[model samples]
Target chain A: DAGVTQSPTHLIKTRGQQVTLRCSPKSGHDTVCWYQQALGQGPQFIFQYYEEEERQRGNFPDRFSGHQFPNYSSELNVNALLLGDSALYLCASSLDLIQETQYFGPGTRLLVL
Target chain B: AQTVTQSQPEMSVQEAETVTLSCTYDTSENNYYLFWYKQPPSRQMILVIRQEAYKQQNATENRFSVNFQKAAKSFSLKISDSQLGDTAMYFCAFITFVGSQGNLIFGKGTKLSVKP
Candidate 1:
């Protein structure tokens, strides 16, 4: 079976620009979550989507948002990006909203100038 | 809020040797879950092992095992017969059961280097 997959392996953007990262969750999974991993640091949770609605969110600012399609694919959008936004964006998917175990994707690398 | 801490910033072990990575977490919830994820140079967060709070027995997967002291809020990962492939950054993560959909809180990570 296919595991979680993400698009746009790498992206380059300037401050104030917006970027969207895509994710295709693992087969048989329904919940999707986003995370940001800065250089030399572990991933920090962004938000989680279930039933096409955000069910839980981290301490991220409003500039970060996400969407989950019926097929369980997800998109992470960052607007008015800052230099700190340059990091690896990871996508994870679980079997359901209640399942705590999540399978993660390789992640998309974003560089903000 | 929950926090995961990995005390060792870097660790090294010779091939075929054993290494242990330490982790501690702070949480008020009685029921939760802990995990150890391995991220190689490719940067894929691969699940190494997981331990449920309520389960008294420690979790083990092949050569990887965890020493989970729930009462002390400590979780340490022990890698046996380490190989070159085991050289990577290992992160400890936690998630509480209070919020069914709560996301994982990861530690800063410990970089493990296996010398051949």
Candidate 2:
């Protein structure tokens, strides 16, 4: 079975630019969540998508948004990025909706230069 | 809001030895879940172990075990017979059981170095 997969292993962008990261949920999984991990720090939850709608969100600003397709794949879009936006964007997939164990992907590294 | 705390910023363990990473969380909810995730140099958040709040028995997976003290709101991860592969940043995470939304709150993380 294939685990969660993310695209654009690495990216470079400038301040005020926009970037979108993609993720394919693990087989048999339906829920997708996004997280941001800065260097030497733990990941901070961005948001979660279920049934093609955002069910939960963290303290992130409106610049951060996400979409979940019918196939359970997800995309995280960040607009008007700031220097702090440069971090590793991780995608996690869970089988259930009630805070079950989440399987994570390799993550896409974003660098705002 | 739930908050997880990992006091140890860095820890070192000799190969084949055991190391314990401490974590404490603050939550008002009676029911919740806790997790320990390991991130190696690859930066992938790998689930190491999980413990349900209602379960009195501690959760263990192979060489990884957790000491969950519900009264004290503490959850510590114990890695036995550590190996070079165990060297990584370990994060403690928490989530409440209030809703279908599974939002995880994570600690700063503890960097574990296994010396060969």
Candidate 3:
């Protein structure tokens, strides 16, 4: 019974560069959502993926995008990264949209230089 | 839009003692859900407890319990016989279903430290 897992526990990128973070949702889960947690702040919703299509998105710019594979794994891509993009990227998965209890991964720490 | 607020930025409790963290949220919807998540130094977000707005009885998970006042829009977590392992950043979150979508909102968080 593996829980939600994220790849590249940490990442470093430069301004104007692009980066991709990966997430494998918990077993028996289908919906994946991404969140950004800045230093000394709570996580802000990025977007959510369900049925291989983006269902909802937050206030993030177009530079932030994501995809969900058929296996329920997800990838978050950020382009033209800015120093402010540096934060902890958290991936949460729930059984379904109606089930609000989301299990989160350890998160990937992004550091933009 | 809904917002959750944790008034206490930090708090401390003696080992084996009890501590309560306060949270207040703003929402106009009638049906919703509230949650308390614990994030340790390791950075893994763990769900502590949850409360459904329609339920009158407070939700309790062993040593963890919540005081949910729907009219006051308040949800507070009480940790009994606190342990060192309980030290972590606690976040209050809200979820509500509107139309065909659901929204999850989180508060800044309250850092709790249990001193031995």
Candidate 4:
């Protein structure tokens, strides 16, 4: 019974560069959501993927995008990274859209240099 | 817009003592959910406890309990007989279903240090 897992525990990217962070949701779950936690701040919603399509997105700009695969894994991509993009990227998975509590991955720390 | 607020930024509790972290939220909806999540230095978010708006009885899990006052929009966590392992950043969160989507909103967090 593996929980949610994320890849590249940490990443460093320069301005104007692109980076991809991956997430494998907890077993027996199907919905994946992404969040960004900045230093000294709580996580802010990024977007969520359901049924391989984006359901709802937060106030993030178009530079942030993500994909949900058929296997329920997800990848968060950030383009033209700015120093402010540096934060902890978290992936949370739920068994369904409305009822179940979400399980989170350890998260990927993204450092935009 | 719904928002959760945790006023205490940092607090310390002597081991074996009790400490309560305060939280207040703003929302117009009558039905929703509130959660307290603990994040240790390792950064994995763990659910501590949760409360539903309509439930009158406070939610409790062993040494962890919540005082949920729906009318006052206040939800606070009380940890009894605190242990050093309880030290972590505690976050208050809000979520509500609208049609079918509910985005979790979290407060800045309260850092609790259970000192031995």
Task: Show where candidate 2 strays beyond 4 Å.
Answer: none
User: Ten residues in a row with the worst lDDT in model 1 chain A?
Assistant: A93-102
- Please give the TM-score that candidate 4 achieves against the real structure: 0.98
Angstrom error at residue A101, model 1: 0.7
Q: What share of the true interface contacts does candidate 1 keep?
A: 0.88
Any runs in candidate 1 off by more than 4 Å, and if so which? none
Q: Report the C-alpha lDDT of model 1 over B7-29, residue by residue, as the tens digit.
A: 99999999999999999999998
Candidate no. 3 TM-score:
0.99
Per-residue lDDT for A1-113 in model 1, tens only? Answer: 99999999999999999999999999999999999999999999999999999998988999999999989899999999999999999999999998989999999999999
Better candidate number, 1 or 2, judged by lDDT: 1
The Cα error of candidate 4 at residue B96, in Å, is 0.3
Tens-digit lDDT track of model 3 for A21-76: 99999999999999999998999999999999999999999999999999999999
Q: What is the lDDT of residue B9 in candidate 4?
A: 99
Clashing pairs in 3: none
Of candidate 3 chain A, the 10-residue stretch with the lowest lDDT total is A94-103
Q: lDDT, candidate 2, residue A18?
A: 95
Across residues B1-116, which tens digit of lDDT does each residue of candidate 3 receive? 68999999999999999999999999999999999999999999999999999999999999999999999999999999999999999999998887657757999999999999
The CA lDDT at A32 in model 1 is 94
Chain B TM-scores of the candidates: 0.97, 0.97, 0.98, 0.98
Over B2-101, each residue of candidate 4 has an lDDT whose tens digit, in order, gives 8889999999999999999999999988889899999999999999998988899999999999999999999999999999999999999988888888
